[model samples]
Target: MDGATGFAVSALVNILLSLAGIALSWWVLQNVRLDLFLREPKGIQAKVLYILLSIIFGHGLASFLNDYMSWSQMLGSLFG
Candidate 1:
């Protein structure tokens, strides 16, 4: 692929991965006892906190996956 096409594909993949990571994180977070940590677990603040935490964790997970993928792709050059 040309540089431009490669970049576009990479961008799409990154977006998809990040979204999947966020969804997965949100699903996983649902099982946690967030109520134990929050003084007003049933309030809007708790909901916002949950969303923020999901985003943070999801981004971290996505970043790690992206880095791992990038490193693996570079391995071809090392082996070539």
Candidate 2:
């Protein structure tokens, strides 16, 4: 692929990975008992907090995965 095409593909992959990460984070967070830590677990603020937490954790997870994938791909250069 040309540079432009490669870049586009990479961008798409990153977006998909980020979305998947966010979804996975949200799903996993659903099992947590927020009521133990929040005074108004059922309130709108709590819902907003949940969304923020999911994004934060999801971004972190996605970043880690992206870096790992990049590093693994770079490994091939060592033997080439």
Candidate 3:
């Protein structure tokens, strides 16, 4: 494959990996029973928004941490 094609493939793969993290985070938050985490909202819309934000932030943070861990491991392997 050409350089451009390889770069595109890598970008696509990264996007998919991040998306998978997001989906898993959303699924776990929605289905996992955690009473403390669920705050009672005054309205349906507010509740929905809260959950949506939570999922987005949770997934994004998880994805970041995952990437960081992978990088750290790679660095350790390179240096050790």
TM, every model: 0.96, 0.96, 0.49
**lDDT tens digits by residue: candidate 3, 27-68:** 666655554554654557655765676668766876786688
The 10 consecutive residues of candidate 3 with the worst lDDT sum are: 33-42
By how many angstroms RMSD does model 3 differ from the true structure? 4.6
Q: Which runs of model 1 end up more than 4 angstroms from their true locations?
A: none
Q: Highest lDDT among the candidates is held by which one? A: 1
Is 2 or 3 the stronger prediction by lDDT? 2
Clashes of each: 0, 0, 0
- Between candidates 1 and 3, the one scoring higher on TM-score is 1
Minimum summed lDDT over a 10-residue window in model 1 is located at 47-56
lDDT of each: 0.94, 0.92, 0.69
Predict model 3's lDDT versus the native: 0.69
